[model samples]
Target chain A: MLTPLLLHVSILGLAAASALGLFATRRESPSMLGSARILAIVATLLVLALQLRRGMEFGGLPLVSRFDTLLMVAVLIVGAALSIDLTRGLSVLMIGALPVALAPLLFAAAIGMPDEHPERNLMHPAVGVHVFLTLGAYAVFGVAFVASILYLIEHRQLKARTGPSLLGMMPSLETSYRLTLRALAAGLVLLTAGIVLGYLYGRQVLSGASWRLDAKVWLTTVSWIFYVIVFGMSFVPAFKGRRTALASVACFVIVMATSWVASFWSHFHRYP
Target chain B: MELSVVGVNHRGAPVEVREQLSFEEARLPEALAELRRATGAAEAVILSTCNRVELYTVRAEGAAGAMESSHWLALQRGVPDSAIASVLYRHAGLDVIRHLFRVAGGLDAMVLGETQIIAQVKEAYRVAKDSGHADRVFNVLFQRALRVAKQIHTTTAIGAGGASVPAVAARLAGKVFQNLAQKRVMIVGAGETGEFTLAAFHERGTLDPLVVNRTVEHAERLIARFGGRAVGLDRLAGTLPEADVVITCLGSSEFCVTPDMVETAVRARRGEPIVFIDIAVPRNVHPGVNRIENIYLFDIDDLQGIVAQNISEREHELARCEPLIDSEARRALQELGEADVHEVVGRLRDAQHAMADEELRKTWPKLGALSPDQRQEIEYLLKRVTNKILHGPTTAIKEAARDGSTPVNFLEIVTKLFRIK
Candidate 1:
């Protein structure tokens, strides 16, 4: 319960710090920006620690339920990101990294809790492999999605020729797009492997019921298909830049919607 | 004490006037000597660059001396006193100190935080010193100015983005292609902007440059600078196929590099990344070249947009540097103030010692008649009297020094009372 309390407060603090950073950046206040960066880093770490604790409690390992696993993944990504950013001595990114770290946790909260116990027959090593790889891909996708949103916002401001804002502190357009492409490429590979493994594991475990289309299974498959199209087009000789960025944003929208519906079903119907 | 800077700059005067005021490098040493001689300047440094010519001089006596020096400098430049006098900025004491600090710190640089100005100031100081013009006061002032410049460079983000259009172009190129050393750079023109880009690319060492211009001679000149070869405009179509980076700075009415030509080049290079930088005002490269597969084209507008953004970013960070400069400025001022006080006190103490020595010489024969013990006792009593006589004046002088009141009147009274010159 205190884990949830700490997580909520830390998220709120991150939000408030980002707001302050934005305001300071707008008003061109250096001290305010410095303080905002400090607040963002500390609060992000606090929330991450709470998630790590919860992850260990749930699974003994960091992965058990999808909820625990996603929370743990988000924390690790942000922690790694901020650590890299810290070396560059750019405090401006602290505010940029916060909401990106917070999105997954907030999404997890909106989704219902995982089942306390379930049938053990579906939990084979192969199935577990499939689940973990897909989860990992989704985590990478989450990072790409966050970066894409920032890229679009920055690109718009640049196009409008507006003055300096907090958004200007983000990396250049090409860097963001490259990061998203790399993330999506890795995620797509894992997703492909995961889907194949799941299909193979399902046939072995559930026999005739393996072919019975579950909404979650179809939704995941559809999102996976969109990612394939995105991954394929990205490597096309002419389709590397603005077209690739558009595809990534589109895939993100698809991934977000499908995941939302899956969480909805899991909450209302107690479906895995 | 008074200080004055009288000169014309690129912003204030036309090239004809600025060049007239400009001190050629060969003549600078003699010019500094002449400046000191004509004005009876205690300290001076003459900063002469193509963009600006400034004479910084210090006269410890009064404003009249500084004005005389400014007049001399104007006369040397052959400009009428009334014509150039309005732009002549004069300051005494603290204002002069602040103005120099700002100039040396790059706060007053045309391109903010440009490193060239500090070196320029040092060169001017050296010339003055070589010509026996820079005295102790000017030496201290210029040394402190250089140190403040170094401090700002190391401690703040003032020099971030390198404070130049070329550096900005290099940064943007790095972000786009991620590596410049492996790329081939083709310059479509041999103008000033093209030369700047060539320098940036050469500095990054990521690309082998190829210069192509309308005239082979013009292309040859730019190519020679980078130790690269030149080609005619006819070969640009062929060279475009192999170049990883193409930069155009030809101020042409029509496009020199077209989309159809780039489209062919992209196919020829397969899917290799190509970056096009157009720094020309009239846009030398075709806008539609951006549509070519695996080819990224950014025009002058785009690069200038980035430059504008970078400038604003630096300006935002300037807010952070403002307090840093103020604190450093205050520290510098306090140090100079204290040094002035110390100098005045040292002179006063020396004058006191001279008077005491005179009095002792007169009384030594009278004291010889006393016993040895009595003689030693009398000497101690005389030393005590000397200390007692000097104590109040020394304390008042030091207090006035820190209070920044110069203590000139008090110093005069003490000298008169002690009969010490």
Candidate 2:
């Protein structure tokens, strides 16, 4: 009963924070933004607590369930976004981050948790590291995706010469672009390490099973290549502003597809 | 005492008339003293800016005080009374409170929601205070007006965006760069518009901007006024790579900055972002330069468009600010009124106790054979009776004040009935 109540409260908190954040951006109100930030922090902490409880119940890291994965990703996104806001005074990013963080939780709620959890080997430390690293990369890329979207909106508004209030509430174009590149760089490094560890683990566990042909593996590789290209294009002068923002947005879509949609068809990477 | 404001603002007067009535800051103290003496005002503050010349005063309650203040302002400024008679406006009591609050909050500014007027108002108050013209009533009035202005700005989006061309240019630069102070700025002309743009940048902490003009002497003159190395127009290409922001207003028909030049600068800077603000009439920078990577370009029309949009937004916020200012003015008037009522109530209570003490003293001598304990009981009884007699009127006056009734008239009635001078 207590666990369910905590889950409901966490979800409600995130939903309220997302709503308030959007309103704050539209109204350009600092006090409302402050309230949203506090709500987001409380919700993020509750989500972390839920994850810890699940890990304790599973006797290891809770990486075998889709609900667990989504919850972990949501926590990381809010945590990273909050850290940036607090440290750098970029509270405007919360306008995008809060809604993005709430999406995964809402999705998890829509698809209820599996009744009988699939039993899997959770003793391998390498697998744990790989899962955690990969999810962390996704969360960071989610922030990059948000920054890219904000950059595009602000760029369009500047080009059209409208929406002064909206423009005032957004971060600068250069700031958003710089944030995208920073997040992409950090995500790229972590993803590379996670992929390398996952490859080693795959070879050890599924030897001679043609695991390389797995749909999840192919989609993950494609997303990784897209991110690599986006990161590389940041250095090219011709693709600096709008093109780079668009590329970041497209690449994150691919990342999301790889993580959620591609997992269903993979025989070896199934999660209940 | 009653509060009054009599003046001519931009809404009521033309520049020709306003300039005639404008006060020199150096002579403000003498003018303030003269104003008080002429109008028999207990306190006064003369706020004279480019757009308005207002004399705020506190004096005996009557229409005569406002009329006298208006005539004094025009006569002191050496303008004929007939010159400003039609344009002069007067507000007394609550209207005075509302008008001052709106002025301080920038709602009455030529540019709605502009912030400079707040500083100007502050300086005016400071002058009044230093000259000993600001006393209890003006002090409370001006301080509350400043606080209301701050609250309005903080809680509303009325001051969110730039409302002028030069300001919009700086705002555009801010959008393209994270930290403007560290960025190198290049001014491609030495005209008045260029100077204004440079001043806008300097206000944001970009002090040393490169001044480039066709005439080396002109560049040097600008450099002397604002700190920066002067460069001739021939060295534009050599210095282009070092500047993160370029503001051009050379008033030339030819394109001073072309795509080729920006491409070379981009290659030299290794793809660092650069913003070109071409505020020239014939367009100083080529339109094709906007296509270059890491280059953002805006012209005069673009800056004006943003300024127009920002001004419209500020105007829309006035609806939100009006109600807030109205409520605040009402609340401030009530508080100030309650303060006066409290003083009168204290006087009334003191008078009642004094009368009771006198009566008790006279009776105690008559009862010469009374014991010490009996005398003490009689003193306590006298004090309690005095308090009970004053309590009903005090409660009625306070309740009237709190309910937003005719508090001033009610306090007057109480003061007259009790004869509590």
Relative to the true structure, how large is the alpha-carbon lDDT of every model?
A: 0.69, 0.86
**What's the lDDT for residue B383 in model 2?**
88
**TM-score for each predicted model, relative to the true structure:** 0.73, 0.91
In candidate 1, which residue pairs get closer than 3 Å at backbone N, Cα or C atoms, i.e. clash?
Answer: B180-B206, B181-B206
Interface RMSD of each: 5.1, 2.4
Cα error, residue A31 of model 2, in Å, equals 3.1
lDDT (10s digit) by residue, model 2, range B135-209: 888888889999999999999878878888888888888887888888888999987988898889988888588
Please, what are the lDDT tens digits per residue for candidate 1 over residues A17-56?
A: 7788777655545678777777776776776677567555
Task: State the weakest 10-residue window (summed lDDT) of model 2 chain A.
Answer: A158-167
Cand. 2 Cα-lDDT: 0.86
Off by over 4 Å in 2: A1-12, A117-120, A123-126, A162-166, A196-225, A265-268, B14-20, B24-34, B60-67, B234-238, B407-413
Candidate whose DockQ is highest: 2
Which residue pairs in candidate 2 have backbone atoms (N, alpha carbon, C) closer than 3 angstroms, thus clashing? none
Model 2, A192-229: lDDT tens digits are 99889999898887779678898888888888899999
Leading candidate by TM-score:
2
